[model samples]
Target: MEVPSSEELLQFLSSCLSQIKWRLKSNSKRRLEIDVLALCTGMRPVVMIDYGGKMPELQNRLLSLLELIREGLPVFKDLKVMVIEDMIYLINVRSLPKFVSSSLDSEPELFFIDLEQDPPKMVTQSKESNLGMQLRSIQKLFSSTFPLDDSNTDTTTVLDEANSSQTSLCIDLSCCLQDTKVTIPTLNGWLLDYPVVYLFGTDHIEEAIYNLSTKSLRLFKVLVCRNGTTEKDSHLEELTSAI
Candidate 1:
């Protein structure tokens, strides 16, 4: 299979953005990378965010790409926004609440990157490892804020521990979040309320969807929205804005 050219990828990205009404930021940073890549395939810069690993080279490459893109399309450098924890929260802040309706913690987001589709992975195993390392370091740094019952456990540790191995990483949120209460036969029903709730393993887009679906199974109101999307990227922004 042939890898997608930078021009092709840019076009595809543009088309996607256009569908969502996102105007391409006209700035040096966005255009420079494309121009440079058009001139030399060897200079193609890739940006990858791997939650499972760490790679310093990936960071450096991203910086290079940003610099190049800035040189060509200056508006891009300022267009990107970063948010943490809550995808819905970001949408709310943007006043685009409609896209967030399905994106509440109950519905979360699901993103599938098919290798068979555009942009075949340029990120190597080494780069993935580096990204993983960086993630671990970050987790360690923020461990206190998001401490796990067992820090050494895998991301799906709660599912394995709770379901006695019957569950995969695809377990329900109630289980993963420790929201379900199992009392003796006297009160053998799941509790409706929880306090000081800490939801772990929800960092990935896939995990978020799973959690949302799980909560849905429990009949809770959940919203699922794609990350970083807003009025520019969705019609749902209309409904959100109306409210």
Candidate 2:
């Protein structure tokens, strides 16, 4: 049988994120966008949400925010890291976003290393991650959102309060290799870690840059699932606020 498609893998991964199957968008709720972005963008690991039109607006904002950092806009340095992850989740990012040239040891061991006689080609990004790399040759379409920052936070625009920041998601073996290997038994999870400056509330979204200067707050995260063509109005304000 052919392998599971990326969308299927995404669905499965989202299910795995929630530890359930039904009502992902609503169940995950407020945490939806933040949760998914943390996964897809974190230098460490994990997206399970879709915010409709608002999603695109947030994407444009995030992309604009990220580009500012690329162009040396010191005001937005803190947000630069998440920008990578947000880029993929915000838009139909197909080709890999060119790696920003990082030092080695920035990530854990590549999962692909265990296979093949000669060590697999050494690269910063691939079809899968360290663990995903080791499994069947599945796609790693999106790469880690970390690795692109300056060595320290003293030089950026976001998270000015904390000395250093990080975010992580607990992922299991299934995410690494979905359809390629079936009928597998109980699975264990590994912690995907990433650097991040956490914000406390949705209002913090407005103060993202300012909050970095405050030194006492947490980052935000969320997860979601697609439900037909219409926007669910129940959480429209919350979702719109997040976007």
Candidate 3:
């Protein structure tokens, strides 16, 4: 079976997130020895692609994977999302009890996917979906990281713990600052600069503002605009705060 390239994974994530919050970047620091990392709106995210746990007999490799995820706990700001691909089929065929035992955390965004499909999307239905949903308990984590956006004026919804001493790294609004016309040299530079993102826009770019202001499930942290969108088109007062 073929695997989706890193580029493909980025695009897939962009579609899921709406391409606003993250941009693909290389693992120069090799944080967690990850093959791919992306800059997210309020946090940095790491994606482990095309990885299936080692054979049950190879306990060492499996243990290593667990340690890597555990060590990265603080680095991810408690928001680690793992999107599995064809590996689900492998698990279904032979129950890997240990790997399942390891990922049973309250936090971390867990997704089940079938790469063989034309578009390579998340698995929403069937037997595997139920198991995946049980393991992905993302709410337990986000309940602590993000706060309820009761008002439209709230732009940065980072929780207090994120700013506390426990979490050394905190995402800020500095990334959106621009007076200079910065030139990104290459694709690598683009990824490094933009990183991986999830965008939800109203008109593909500004469209997200309307959705974000009204709805609570914001997929993006930083809002992207091409022609300088303003509150004229959007009804919410907080629409201006997204960028």
lDDT of each: 0.28, 0.30, 0.27
lDDT of 2 at 56: 41
Per-residue alpha-carbon lDDT of model 3 for 3-51, expressed as tens digits? Answer: 4443444344334323232222433222222222232222222222223
**TM-scores for every predicted model:** 0.21, 0.22, 0.20
The digit string of per-residue lDDT tens for model 1 on 1-243 reads: 455554554655454444444343465334433433322332111111322112434333334443444354433332121122111000111121222232232233222221221232222212333333333333232232222343544445544454464212111222322332211110101011111111222234354345444442233332223234455763221101000
What is the clash count for each candidate, in the order shown?
33, 34, 21
lDDT of 2 by residue, 119-145 (tens): 223333244443333321322212332
Q: Judged by TM-score relative to the true structure, which candidate is superior, 1 or 2? A: 2
User: Who is ahead in TM-score, 1 or 3?
Assistant: 1
Worst 10 residues of 3 by lDDT: 85-94
Over all chains combined, what TM-score does candidate 1 have? Answer: 0.21
Best-fitting candidate, measured by lDDT?
A: 2
Stretches > 4 Å off in candidate 3: 1-112, 115-122, 125-131, 149-164, 167-225, 228-243
